[model samples]
Structures are given as C-alpha cells and as structure tokens.
Target: MEDQTPTRKNNSYCKRKIVTVLTATLTDVAQQTRAAAQDLAGLSTDLKNQALESIAQALEAATPKILEANAKDCQRAQESGLATALYARLKLDATKLAGAIAGVRSVASLTDPVGSIQLHRELDTGLELKRVSCPLGVLGVIFEARPDAVMQISALAIKSGNGVLLKGGQEAIHSCQALVEAIQTGLAASTVAPEAVALLTSREETLELLNLDQYVNLIIPRGSNSFVRFVQENTRIPVLGHAEGICHLYIDQQANIAQSVDVAVDSKIQYPAACNALETLLVHKDIASDYLPKAVKALQNQGVELRGDAAVRDVIEMDSATDTDWATEYSDLVLSIKVVDGLEDAIAHINTYGSGHTDAIMTTDDQAAATFCSRVDAAGVFHNCSTRFADGFRYGFGAEVGISTQRMPPRGPVGLEGLVTYKYLLQGQGHIVATYAGEDAQSFTHRDL
Candidate 1:
C-alpha cells in the first residue's frame, strides 16, 4: 500500500479521469436530450400544461437562493471596480427576483405553439401538405450579467419544447449557477430531461460550447456590441440577435412642444443605461430656436450632458458634439443633439447613423407620423411615446430573451413565440412524384393562410 506511483503517471491518470468524466457527461446529456425531444414532440396538451405548472412552482421556490447568489455577484462586482451601470445590471434584489419568477409563470400561461398547424394544402390525389410549428432542437445562448435573462430564456425554450445551453457572464457565475440548479430541479420534478438545460461553468467551457456546432442548432448572443460581433465572426452557427441599440428621438416642426419636451426628457433620463434609452435627439430647424434651448435645459436639470451641433450650440451653451457623437450609444447620462432641416433630413440621419433598434418621432400631423413610422429602419417606431417603451415587457410580451434588430423573422423582442419555427409535412399515400414532372402536370393551388 505504501508503494509510490510516478508523478507523471499520476498526472496522466488525473487527466484521463477528467477527460473520461467530460466525455461521459456529454454522452449522457445527448441521450437525455434526444429522449426529451422525442417525448416533447409526442406530448399531449395535458402533459405540457403540467410541466409548465411545475416550472412555475420551481421558480417561485428558488427565490431565496437566487437572491443570495445575486448578492455575492453584486458584492464581487462592486469590489472589482466594475462600472456603476454594469454593477446595476449585475445586481438583483427582491423585486427583480419576484419579477423573474413571474416571467416564468407568464411563459407557462402562454399557449403552446408546438404542433400548431400554420398552413395546409393538397399537392395531388393522395398527397396532403401541412406546415406546423416545431422546436429549433437545441439553442445556445451567450449573455452578459443579467441573471433574470436565464430564467426568461429557459422558460421560453422549455415552453417551446427546445433544449437550451446557457453561457452567462463570469461576473454573475454564482447567481447563474444557482438559477441553473433550480431549473434542473424543476425539470426533474416535471419528468423533463434535466440535461435539456445545460449551463457552461467556465469561460473555457463557453468557448468549447461555441464550437459544439454539431450539437447546437442556433446561437443567440445578448450582450455588448463587441461581444455580439465577436460571437458572430467566430462561430458558423446562425446568430439571432443585435449588436447595438443607437435609438433616436426626433421632434418635428409640427410637434406639440410640450409633449415633445416631455417625451425627449423621459426617453433620455428615465433609464439612461438601458438599450432602449434615447442616445440622440434630432429637432427640426424651423422649431430649433424655440425648442432646442428648452429641451437642453430640461435634460441638464436632470444631470444629462447635452452634446450638440453648431446650430444646437448657438441655441444652448453645451459641449460641441462631433460626427462620432451621432453614431455613439452612450449608455449613460449623456445625449447627442442635432438640428435637422426638415423631415427628410431627420429620416436620412436616422437611417444612416441609427442602429436599427428603436426610434421615435414627435409630430402632430398625421402624414408626418405615418411617414416617420414607415421610413425609419428600426425594429420599433414610436409616434408620441418615449423610446424607453421599446421593451418586451412594456410591449406586453411577458418576458424577452433579447431585443433583436436583425432584418429577419424575429426583428424585435424575442419572447416565447419567437422560440418556435415552422416545418412543412407532406403526407402521401402511394403518390409518385414522377406524375407531376411532365409539362401537362396538374396545377397545384396555393391558398393563403
């Protein structure tokens, strides 16, 4: 028993053990997920309802643990000299924890979209065509320090009958780990495969997960512009998210002056650090002399730094903003102001420099509002409301995985409905395709849904 093994041999044995463990984990996860997918596809409405109820219960019960883990993340972030805005994002108190739980319950309440037939048609005598909603298999989500996003995405993925692999920021590792534990426990209780919901434990593991394209179907990155860009360029998987939110608020010449001022102030100062918060303010030149100074003064009173163009500076004494200012997404208590010639200039400026995220136009004229709403290349175009309303929750979507600005199917807040995709099913009884290949083939009628 006292015989000593060589150090090199012992090291090799340890490495082998780790490799064996990782291999076994992945294998088991794959098997469980495959089983889960099959079961989900065959799930009755009753079983799905029961699973959702169990998930809601689990989220509610895990509140205390969630709060404790969030406290640790907040303390660490504060000690590590993280930016105040970032720290706020990482911190989650009781209210946010409750809201997260509510979000899970909200997903449970939404109608199950899986198996819902979107379209149906007949190709030939014995062939029938149908298009039904189905899960996207496995979704890999890489996100920053927002612990609640984990719960929201997990609920949506499960409700949509898809597997999820989450890679959260290291800053909120403890919180994310705790949340994952709760989710797994819920899955076990509901007889759902726990492996269907996996969380990466380390940054290196995240990189490895990103490369697991064979296992992952879609990649959704929700974080800073740099992080999103890095994921997009590094991975071949299709990404479903946006890089930035350079939202703008424009005040037209025909705008109600009082409403314009209120909307501008509220949009910029209500929650300056959020993506939907206004970063730039464009005012019509005809009314700039009367409105620019007033708006600047109101923002300054709220501690917002007003950086303006030459015309704006002439109206109000503020920092001279450069061309770069128009393109910046200063997620802070700062704003860029530019005075435009008219509606055309305003539209041109937003389309050229905006992030295609969210923009608003304040105008009293019906045609002006219609033109602004139709022309702006943004996910959301508001008429009189503040840009801050560009949120899934605010738009009545229960919860959102992220706000997408891509010119694709999901161009706005991605909620439970966004997690599902469509598949076409063709049922034929001894119908040969060769019969339809001739020049005098029977014409197929295409009916609209």
Candidate 2:
C-alpha cells in the first residue's frame, strides 16, 4: 500500500510508449492476441498458475498507484455528474483492491480448465478418440466503469489460457489503463505473452474491435441494456452478456415478515447499483396487510425511495408506481412494490417484467418455494437468500468475465470453464473408410476409456 508504483523488469511490450504502438489498430491487436492465445494454449497448468500469481502480487504491491489513478476518475466523474452507483463501482480503495487481488490468488489455486480430458473412448480396433478442453482463442471484453473488472478479466483470461482485449468505459480510463499496465507488466515477468492482454482506449477503437470476428472468438459486453444491444447488433461476432437486470423478489403468503424485510433491505441497500439488486418487490395480497408497512419502514430507514401500486399505497405513504414501473430497472435506492393475488400472480408478473437475470422468493412453505424456483425463468433463482448473492466472486468462480444471461454454454457467472471449448481428437493406425463402408463392413466397438 505504499505510494510508489510496483515496477516490473524492463520489457518493451508493457512500456507506455511501446504498448501504444503495439495496439495501433484493432485488427492488428486481434491478430496478435489470437497468436498469443495459441501459444498460451500450449503452456502447462503450472505456468498458467504462475502468471496468475504474478498478477496478484503485482496488483497487491501497486495498490497505491491504482487508487491514485481511480481518485482522478472519481473526481472527474463527480464534476461531470456520473451516476451514483457507477461512481461507487469506479472508485477503488484499499479494501476493493485487496479483494480483487485475493480473487486473482484464488484463481491461481483453481484447477486448470484447459487441456483437461472431458471424455476418452475406444473406437473399433486400433482406433482411439479423446475430447479435451481448450482455450476459446481471443476474447473482446467491453465493460463499464467498474475498474475492478479490468483486473478480474485479465486474471481469469490468463488462468484459463486465453487472450483478452479489455475495453473499459471512458469514465474510468485512468484506472483501467493503470490496471492493464500492471497486468501486462506481470505477464512480461512470467512465461506468458505480454500482448496476450491489451486495453482499448477510445470509443472509435472499440467499435472497430467488434468487427474482428475472425480473430476474436467471443465478445463479452458488461454495461447497460442499450450498450450491450449495440455491441450485439454491430458485428458478426458472437456476443455473451445480458441486456438488462430487472431483478425481482417475491414475498409469499407463507413468508416471515422479519426475514423478508432483512432480505429486501440487503438486496437493495447493500449495493443498489449492481445487476443483481432487487428492482421489484412482489407481495401476496393475503400478506400485504401485515408486510407492507414493515417493508416500507425497513427500506426507508436505509434511504430507499418506495414507489408502489394502489393497494401498496393504501398501506404506505409513497409515490404511485405506474404500469411502466414493472419493467423498469432503477439501479439505485429505488424500490417498486406490487401486491399480487398469490404465488401464481407473482410468478406471472415476474415472467412478464423480469429481465431473466436473477429472481428470489421468500417463503416457509416447501411447496411454495419449490414451485416458485422451478417456474421462475432466470439465470439465478434463490429460495430465501438476498438477490445480492448473485455474483461471480460469491459463486466461487475465482473471478468472472461477466454474468451471462445468454442461453448458451457459458451461462450465469462465466469463469474459467466458460472461457474454454472442447475439441475432439481421433487417433487411428492405418484405418481406411473403405473397410467400414459396404458389404465387408467391420463391426465397431464404442467403448468408454
């Protein structure tokens, strides 16, 4: 936590001037990053872990520099009127930096996902086949003002033996640049390629980056709905991310008031700006008489603004919530309350308005909880926990590239396993297709190995 920056051994790839030159064009960076990932795929697990450890050490040692850089971003954001929650995400102090470094160390301790044999099989005489996990080539990760995202993505990429090009929001340029510099410097000291991890500075360059579908295997954009949609439509490349986070928490008739209040406060107040923060609160009409007042008071005590329907307004003093409120994602200390008929009504409302990111239900009845969890269509469905638990680090992913709502292989918190794809390898000794084609066809044995 000293004031000085941690210095790395002299290497041209991470040098300020050199990095700028090396990342001149989006196409060039993509090609170079793909090449780097190809080399990374050949490295041993120990070597990958070493690179992650180096990144952790470097980040811990350079805490002061990172914070100082983040200070500038925070000051500028305040002057320019940045969103309250986004400013919170952008500012990195001693604690958040420590957590980021610890996450990297944890990733170092995880089992390597790449090169692991997923399946092995014996096919006929003298023929064998194996399916092994491998890196997903180069990744283009575009995220918002969360500076910690830079470190997390870089560490995850290295640990999974994949290459990354990180593009952070302009609001946290200084912080992102400093974090990437530290990461590339750490890579220089290890056996990994320094160019394996790069940073994009401008919006123009980032838009250009979305076009490199050939070199960039996957694009993960972590930001607002419009931003993610823009990235998805602008290129031919595959995109992995969610458009919105209109999460919900339904309070069942069988729910306990104290437990519901605690969860409601934690979900909205612990970190209101997060993607998993509860946006809508659904209460069964049968329990509204008992739960509405208590829920309002608990949330208001934490400086939360309550907007509710007519039935909820009758029990509490708050702003009148409209039909549009159901579909809104207020990423702040704002809560929308709606009184539903019962479990069926709550489920219908959530499915109609929820963003398919995360949803939770509070209930003492086993049947109610089971029905709610099974019927709710979301990436994460919780029975009684706070919605804030829907996070990558909380899910023990070491560090996530992003929370994916896409219905694909990498759903939910995308960790090391999400960054890899499998390849089928077949070995045969002088085997000819003619031998198994027609009347003299040989019987093949598909035995597991």
Candidates in order have lDDT scores of: 0.79, 0.85
Q: Relative to the unseen true structure, what is the C-alpha lDDT of residue 164 in candidate 2, on a scale of 0 to 100? A: 93
Predicted candidate 2 versus true structure: per-residue lDDT over 1-449, tens digit per residue: 00111122221223122234442456776787888899998999899989988888777777888899999999999998888888888889999899888888898888889889989999887899999999888889988888998888988898888999888888988998888878877888899988899887766666667778888989998877777877787879989977688999999999989999999999999999888999999999989989988889889999999999999988877899998889888889999999999999999999999888999999999999999999988899999989999888888888798888876767888999999999999999998888888888987899998
Models 1 onward score TM values of 0.89, 0.95
lDDT of 2 at 103: 88
Could you tell me how far off, in angstroms, the CA of residue 85 lies in candidate 2 after the best superposition?
A: 1.3
At residue 7, give the lDDT of candidate 1.
Answer: 19
Best by TM-score: 2
Per lDDT, the best of the predicted structures is 2
- Kindly list the per-residue Cα lDDT of model 1 for residues 257-321, writing each as its tens digit: 98899999999989787889999999999999999878877889999988999999888788999
